[model samples]
Target: MTMQSLGDVVGNLVDGIGNERYWRGGKIAEPGVYAGVDIERYHHDPDLFDGFSISSSGLRALLRRPAEYWWSSPYNPSSQEPESKPALDFGKAAHMLLLGEDGFAGQYSLRPATYTDSKGDEKPWNGNATSCKDWLAQQAKAGRTVITETDIAHIRHMADALSRKEAIRLGILNGKIERSIFHKDRDIWLKSRPDVIPISSGDFVDLKTAASVDDETLSRAIFAHGYHVQAGLLRVIVREILGPDAFTSFTFVFVEKAPPYDVRVMQLKDADIDIGERQARQGLKLLRECLRRQEWPGYDGFDQHISYIEMPSWAKTRIDNELNAEAA
Candidate 1:
């Protein structure tokens, strides 16, 4: 969109991803979005903006706490590591089952021996068994994901629950899935891949697997995971590619990762989207500044002064009441 050739875009964003591992096979019918794009490739694609993505998670990691971001992000040479593989695996499985349609089975295998151990006793299968490991290696070789039987059950339960929702069902049954969309705005690269983008409607949905979707737990999860920022990013990217009227509404479908697999569907308010957009902008500005200076400064470098540590009001109230009772 910004007049860069496809080669330039690929060159800029191709640092981490090797040449052989391109977005293997999927193609999109949509006008602007790209299908079958790998997560890493989209993040690093140069077509968006100089091969840098102001991702929601990256922004949160950097702005929420610079020191942590420096340690975790690959941008830092001293302490770079991949994210939790188990969690990523679980989510990947869930997405495949919920959105990937027929291809989900090919990408995953359930451990047949996970139900028991050496003593033939029932165990949760920590994925450490030698046989399990060997099977997983084979799955990897075959370009498939290895998962525990329990993982299959959990994902299945969530899938069943999702099918009960007419709106979600129709969207999934009728729409496109897992297309990576990008937009360049103000010299910044932004991208979003909604779990489900209905071809027939102007609404998009993001599926989230969590501990619980109750009001309190979900709200905390939203804030902690920067779901608001993600919502804004997704909306903005979609709006740019499709049009201002493209994303009339956004929804979050939350399902418990554990038993009962309770599900909740939420539509974010306009105010929530606004707040997220604001945070995303701030994060992008900071990212631009950091890249331009070629320095990723930590928090200690900025405000190292020992500031006042305010106690929680609830804790203070409890302390005061206990002291009064003791005096009485």
Candidate 2:
């Protein structure tokens, strides 16, 4: 068991994520079995790489395309703008914030571009080495217990499964009558908007980050805000792309960064879920509309029209009625 200081591990791999190029001045030229399409070939014909061919087309070419295109290109920033709101950007999330995930129903979904340069040294979602070191220094000054991955792993002598207990409870205590997970199959016409379709379990599992958390505080807050809407949108998109087998539940695992690195699992209920679904549907519609209008939603700037809608009354009413019926 290797228990080095938290300062040692992590923040080293994705330490400088915001950079346009690899963190290291030189390419992360590690000779390993990296699974991905050849970038050189992608340059000529992105389709050969997969569905991302159109999405990955050169910059100048995309600029000539129309505004209604849902896919993004080098110069044509069709996706959310950098100045956009605090919504999760998978690339930025993985590189800037460790909050983004992929791989399985709810594992880590890393893009090929990112995985190509990765070395497993740093974690970006939590910020890079600079932010992490600064936070660590602050923690050290306060005399709090520092539990780095190495320390935790050594103490428990277990490999990465941090949420083992909860997983067992979900799988064993609860009869997962059905469960499903999937990745978004990227294409030129469409983007990678993948999500898991839990046949049951009553919710769509969402992931998020927090500076710190206990247990109880996690449940109430996300009711107001979190990435649940994103999950809901993913649900709707998955249903649209795959078929109608969307998830029935919405779970959020808000991982804290403070001492203890505690994780809070909150099962979104009636109102919480209602809001997400409402927004999910709305956002999807809005995104397409925006694409058609060639007007991307701006996060940094305000939208006077959007502010008029207060969580949607119809959705809330339906949610309340459902809760009342369930209780009855």
Candidate 3:
């Protein structure tokens, strides 16, 4: 046989060694910016990219409940689909109306208030009737989410409220919407899908639907939902894909879902973002270890050690004050 050239031999070796080797069981084989990915595919497709990856929401799950994260991860052999929530569906519909090109009309259909009966008489669609059920099933089969007319009206009002905000309007006008970005951070792969990325200005905006945008309530919600951690992770991914100085700012645009739809815009403080980054790094490290050993521990952790629970400081102070009043 004729001797093969060095280049040919290398090519053969590379072909023999597939991208699977890079996956290392659960890590992504390739990482970079992925643009124009459909939101549904990006969120629902387990094998969208080359291999397993984690988004900001996944990172939040990993931090809060690794077991849940593992159960939901596509990389897991016995992973289960998450149950749908009406609130989440509403949010998605709002996002479609606000961010999607085709709008909610393409992905959602409004359930008629009434349906024609066998006698051609109009009857209220109570959603329990056989015809209504069949109609809903048909909508599902047609890959459309069924929403009430009120939902459509509320979403439209929320969109209208957001439109009046000059800053939000400008950002949406200048930015790319629903772009997915993937980057390998050391051992594990990270993924991010920002709501809006104004490439030239390097400003990013995340849209949120909330019950209240009042300072106190919104502040608590931000911490409770770990929005800061999401902000941190997104900033890192944005900077990694675009140069070091590419990320200029991140803003959260919150809109109330009820009538009179109020809107509020908040920019995260650098200090809070720094804290979020640290927390994100911690979560990533924990994730790497968990994946390496295939051990997913819940909030209680794997230890058999006892956990101590304590009363709140406010409660303790209240009790002390009552005792002093009784003694006096």
**Which number leads on lDDT?**
3
Best model per TM-score: 3
Candidate 1 at residue 293, lDDT?
A: 75
Judged by whole-model lDDT over C-alpha atoms, candidate 1 comes out at: 0.68
Q: How much is the lDDT of residue 5 in candidate 1?
A: 48
| TM-score ranking from best candidate downward | 3, 1, 2
- Candidate no. 1 TM-score: 0.73
In model 1, the clashing pairs are 107-145
Residue lDDT tens for model 1, 1-328: 3444444433322321121122454422223466667665445333433445555667777778666666765445567544548877898788777776556666677667444566777765566776556766788789676777778888888888887877666563455665666677666556676776655556567888887778999888888888888888777777677655566667888888887788788887879888988888777877777778767777654555866778899999999999999999
lDDT of 3 at 269: 89
**Distance (Å) between predicted and true CA of 101, model 1?**
5.7
Instruction: Show where candidate 3 strays beyond 4 Å.
Output: 1-30, 102-106, 118-120, 140-143, 309-328
Q: Where does candidate 1 have its weakest 10-residue lDDT segment?
A: 12-21
Which 10-residue window in model 3 sums to the lowest lDDT? 16-25
Q: What is the lDDT of residue 22 in candidate 3?
A: 23
